[model samples]
Target: MAKHSKKSTNLWSTPAAQVLRATDDTRVEEIDFSLTPGFDGTKADAQELLAERGQVLSALQEKLYANGRSGDLRSILLVLQGMDTAGKGGMVRHVIGLVDPQGVDLASFGVPTKEEREHHYLWRIRNELPGGGKIGVFDRSHYEDVLVVAVHDLVPRQVWEPRFDEINAFEKELVDEGTLVVKVALFVSPEEQRTRLQERLDRPDKYWKYNPGDVTERGFLPQYRLAYQRILDRTNTDYAPWHVIPADRKWYSRLAVTELLIDALERLDLDWPAADFDVEVEKQRLANS
Candidate 1:
């Protein structure tokens, strides 16, 4: 019998990091354990994975619609964060497209307005939280406190450092208040990202999506990675754990996101509220009429 090293055993047997990678698109080929009926992106079954994901989303949308009719008031907040060309928008389009538009809201946060900048960092975010019985999606969220602000030195180091705790506490409060918080950080490799960016530049219609500033941002990929690692390390709590989705393959990214969302909504145990009746009064009114 041959003896195996502990590290090798852990890597091969565990779901730990096999589905995700620190700096490569290879892991996009692996099955995401976080999703049921795990389908690896590189395989031919990728289309099947997406189909299953569609079913789950459809079911979730039905439940949400019924809950809304009964005034059950369930709120879900989905936060998506990633570097440029990481498929944030694409994930949103594919995964949430089937959901009832009335029951869902999508907010994309960009550079703050002058008025928005006047208040505290979270003011803009707080104003956007979902009301009862609705799903709110944030394309890029308050994590900017850690990502963009840190990258550009927009704030003092101490100010941004403490925001990790602030964010965790804030999310905990939302969870405690009957809101389901789902945070997804899409991870894509630099090489894959370069390809996507070049595609955008080459296509006339997609030229709007390309920014000269993105070229500048590409230079600071390492710093952004460090910031993201720290963000994940600090903010990944049970109340709002971050799902690091492998986003090199847009199809796989959408499928994984849809599965995770379905799982979260299922855990809510939502039900349609029972109706109240005033039978005697209704009968009397009917007879009079």
Candidate 2:
């Protein structure tokens, strides 16, 4: 748990990375996920911010893709964890949608199939990891073993408890291999979650998104709370930090994700890949043609 420097610049108001970052002293329970730290304007303001963040992300993603083309061998992964209706799908659609889909490898883990159950929890996850110079999104991801399984007692405590360290090691390996890991916990209040779930049930267009089992899972929030608490406590390392986003405001959640991701990409200090062949020769050949 190395200390991060105290940056004073407020990107949106409390600084993008500072207040959002989950560290040793970060009290997950104390955070007001519903609070809008800045941007007191109407919905239009939020939409404008979203567009700006999207453009910034698109530019950085192109740089990463070019870096990969030049054989730079670097990449990034975004792991999103949250309760149902926390807007994981929305984040993907709004943020990752702005980038080239080919460069983004999205792995949305669901209930394991019979064959998948035969393998280790991380086996499927390992198979979907992005190659160098690509972006990866783990929607739900291996964190299920700890959060979901731990909440339901699907596995014994001993079986799932050790996975915190295992996850840390796995993420560290990614970092050492030129993959930056960014983890996010989309925090939604119980009341807001209920409203979103109701909206799913109410709207015919959203009928497909509604899940009967989500109601069952709602009853286990207490257990899930403990599980998520441990997740932040154990795995919020310097190599891979966890961001707790307030998902109550869907606009803020989406914009903040795009902004934070852009911040991470900018920190990479990526550059345009050097031309592989003689640039002057190619220019002359094209000019002659």
**Local accuracy of candidate 2 as per-residue lDDT tens digits, 1-43:** 1112222123356655666888787776777878765445446
Candidate 1 at 10: error in angstroms? 23
The global C-alpha lDDT for each of the candidates, from Candidate 1 onward, is: 0.74, 0.84
Q: Judged by lDDT, which candidate is best?
A: 2
Native-vs-model 1 lDDT? Answer: 0.74
Candidate 2 yields a Cα-based lDDT of 0.84
Per-candidate TM-scores read 0.82, 0.93
Question: Ten residues in a row with the worst lDDT in model 1?
Answer: 11-20
Residues 177-288 of candidate 1 have per-residue lDDT tens digits of 8889988888777778888889998999999999888889989887887788788777878678777776777766776676667767777876555556687898999999
TM-score of 1: 0.82
- In model 1, residue pairs whose N, Cα or C atoms come closer than 3 Å (at least 3 residues apart or on different chains), thus clashing, are none
Number of the top TM-score candidate: 2
Candidate 1: residue 233 lDDT (0-100): 75
